[model samples]
Target: MQLDRIDYALLDALRKNARLPNKTLAEKVGVAPSTALERVRRLRESGMIQGYHAEIDPQALGIGLQAMISVRLERHARTDVAAFDTYLKTLPEVLSFWHVAGGNDFLVHVAVRDSQRLRDFALDAFTTRKEVAHIETNLIFSFQRNARLPAPPRD
Candidate 1:
């Protein structure tokens, strides 16, 4: 589905604050509340709009330290990979992980209480795993997010 200026406006506005009221969203996008609601529903049905979520601060939740881990798996076999992927979900400290291209198999983002726990986690989690070949860790002293998408391509 082709998105017009109004659709782009709605997307930008909603991503900035998903909790925008129908009336407010309509005004911001220069449309009637009903139209805005209908457009949003269509966006969801078309898979343009995925889902809405609140942005929670890790620090506010008492997670003080954050790190990014580059993981190289020893084996690329499906079973080995599946087992490793399954094991990752069981780690509470892991925030997110992505299977990517390049020198590493996966990039994992984790948040913990401090450096000591991070070291322990690295050893107990990846270092001890047989399928894990190597790990490169980077400490994150700060983090930021801008969920806003760039302007849509001009067609």
Candidate 2:
């Protein structure tokens, strides 16, 4: 969907804080509250804005360990790939999963309370899969930066 300056401004305000009130958004974008609402609705309809979620601190939640696992599958059959993807979704410790092109077919992000739990998850859960040929696990030390793109230039 094509977005004009007002639409872009509304998106920028929402990205900064999705909880911003419609009145505040309208004022910031120099539009009526109803117009801001309409643009936001259109953005949602077009799938440009997926959903809002709160960012939680894993350490505070007692999930101190963060691990990224690169999984290489034995076969690239469609059924086998689907099964593995479905299986990963059912795992509570798995935070995110990605299918990428490289030596590995999948990259899995996991968080656990400690090192032992992380090891158990890697061995008992991941390695046991018949479709999984090899696994490489790496510990994440810290997150440097996680930022969204800058807002489009206002005309």
Which residue pairs in model 2 clash with each other? none
Clash tally for model 1:
0
Estimate every model's Cα lDDT from 0 to 1: 0.93, 0.89
Query: Number of clashes in every candidate structure?
Result: 0, 0
Candidate 1: Cα lDDT at 141: 77
RMSD in angstroms, candidate 2? Answer: 2.4
Which candidate number maximizes lDDT? 1
> In model 2, which runs have C-alpha deviations exceeding 4 angstroms?
150-155
Candidate 1 TM-score, C-alpha based: 0.93
lDDT tens per residue, model 2, 33-142? 99989889999999988998787898999999998999999999999999999999999999999988889999999999999998899999978999999999999998
TM of each candidate vs. truth: 0.93, 0.89
Candidate 2 residue-wise lDDT at 80: 90
Model 1 CA lDDT for position 145? 80
